[model samples]
Target chain A: MSELVDCRGLSCPEPVMLARQALQETGNGTVQVVVSNAVALDNVTRAANQMGWQVSVEEEGEEFKLSIKK
Target chain B: MRDRLSIIFAGAVVGLLAVILVLQGNPANMGFCVACFIRDIAGGLGLHRAGVVQFLRPEIIGLVLGAFVTALYVREFKSTGGSSPLMRFLLGMLMMTGALIFLGCPLRMILRLAGGDWNALVALPGYVLGVWFGTLFLKKGFTLGRSQVQTAVNGYAGPFIAAVLLILLVTAPAFIFFSEEGPGSMAAPLFLTLGAGLLVGILAQRTRLCTMGAIRDLILFKDYHLFLGFAAIFVVALVGNLFTGQFIPGFEDQPVAHVSSLWNFLGMTVVGFAAVLAGGCPMRQLILTGEGQSDALLTVFGMGTGAAFMHNFGLAGSPAGVSPAGQWIAIISLALLFIIGISNVNLHRKAKTKDYSKAS
Candidate 1:
């Protein structure tokens, strides 16, 4: 199972950094990040991609779940 | 489509308001300038003795009240703060200094651009560079730390003060100053200004409209969400200016603006850097204050204090251009921002991050 990083209600840059931290901890495994808003989702996706991860976002109600895998 | 339309609507309304306010008696192409308006409020309260820019702008009061009402209606108002309040306050002061030197905030920058002030173009690159610097800090884990839920009273302070200011504005008390002439004396009808403020405040709070965030998000996330709002304001304002015969292209003799290229660039650069560090633009800070964020409130307080300090000390810029002291303050603001940014960067990468949702 992949690690789940809950970033609900967090703003931009913070969510991006959290996703980066989770990715580093996994180190080539899968990581899932959940954010509350569109801005955070876009930011997290870009950050994960910059770190060489494949990202796919699933809308979960008002929150967005980002699945990032290396 | 709905979301985009809402943002566009918000921006277009703001653009239209600026034009209307200008035509109604506000300064030319300066229907809304948060930094300058806050400075005027400072003067109104006798915080400074600037003769030409003192009136407790009704629009300012209306914005805070409107945001206050909207946040409560939407069930989004919460009292939260305590993440480096003092640092945020200082950043707010520096942010004001930068904006005052530029003679406007980011919102005004967009308005000026729409009015065809090319000097804002020079400031644009500087603002972007400053935001890029801020993004570098974020990449290195720069955060002011998480805030905690504070008492409800803390949340009410901003709006409470705003309401009180509204009273003072209406009463026209003896202690308050009103400019006999100059930009301060120039204002749209009081009720009309207040109504526009309320409407824009609600829309801005609803859409999370922020000019500083527009540039920052573009650089950090390649996200055009906020930039769409930014573009809408520019486009709408340009059209309005053209229709109103207010679009005076070129850098010279712009209304309430000067032609110092270097200071214009650096002033906005300082504003952008400090705003990123403070977590929002000047207008965003006010909106957050209404939503009950004490950290943002302190920043707002700092901005007012900075305005007073700038005017009293003659550190503020005027149409004569930035004084030597104003130039020095802008440069020193950059140094201070660099120090604040570097020192706050957490070098240690926590394997498990702390709660950042509580972050501003």
Candidate 2:
């Protein structure tokens, strides 16, 4: 299984940074980012898209899991 | 990138407006200060009895309206809130306490420095230090949590208030106070001030210009993108000051300024620290409010109330310097900021989650 990026409880740009790093490191396949808030979800989704990745989102409880792929 | 550089141009325009407003009749070195204007607005609304600084500033009204219009036009307006609203309100008050202690917001701080006010120099490091401290909290995973999307009416409230205030100013309602002396008595033409504010609001919203963000970005990522905007404001305003003969670099005899070094430093330190937790500066708060964020609206209310509280309790500083009470307020603000910053962070999450940065 691919490693998950747990960006939960992190502030604004931190979650975005971690998500971007995961995307860059994986270089292919899929990466999922779990964020505790919508702001982080938006930021990470935007960052991933900017890097030319496609993202699908799933809301689980109070957190969101963003699945990103090339 | 060309897009990032646009903020610099926007900052330059704002700087030019500051000088022009002064030439047109704003207080010396007081072009567009959010904290001062909000305080004056509070006094105008009779929230406080500060007679010398009482007027419904049209520039403030224009800022909200302009950003609201621009946000709507760009389809960027989204109504959202419910992330620690009460806490944000108090943090807003904390931010205002700092600004009042220093007699200016971050925007006004840059303008003060541009006007060759030596006092701003001392506040600069303090402000930087505050942002730095905020970065530490960020490193430890501090967050105010997520905000949920709200209905359209929620987003319209802030702009609606601004429009109402504009009408009140034009009609000269009896309920609102207008100052006969001191800074409140000084003002540019209503249309002119409002026009400048509108222009700034539109530009700022488009460029995402923020004083706190400028410092935060530099420290967090070593990215100087936002710093360009900060430098542009200072450079443009400084040159304008020189040509207009407003540049007088000294600690003494500066208009509406204090010579106290320790208070000035501590005051900005409070401002910077609280701003990070709150997610924006005073001007940014206004823009966010215009963009339909209820949390930002609460912060705005906090600032207005804080302004009233400062005057009512005799805690705001003047040219003479901060009172013992105001100094204590400053100290309390820092302590409160520390509590707020530390309490919100869930560092235990860090232990459960693996950092993605090591993936490389």
Best by DockQ: 1
How many angstroms is residue B84 displaced in model 2 relative to the true structure, after the best TM-score fit?
A: 0.3
Count backbone clashes in candidate 1: 0
Q: What is the interface RMSD of each candidate, in Å?
A: 4.9, 5.5
| Per-prediction tally of clashes | 0, 0
lDDT measured at residue B108 in model 2 versus the true structure, 0 to 100: 90
Docking level for model 1: incorrect
Model 2 misplacement above 4 A: A1-11, A14-70, B349-360
RMSD after CA superposition, every candidate: 4.1, 4.7
Model 1's alpha-carbon lDDT is 0.85
How far in Å is the alpha carbon of B144 misplaced in model 1?
Answer: 0.7
In candidate 2 chain A, what residue range of length 10 has the lowest lDDT sum? Answer: A8-17
Task: Give one digit per residue, the lDDT tens place, for model 2 in B129-152.
Answer: 999888899778787876777888
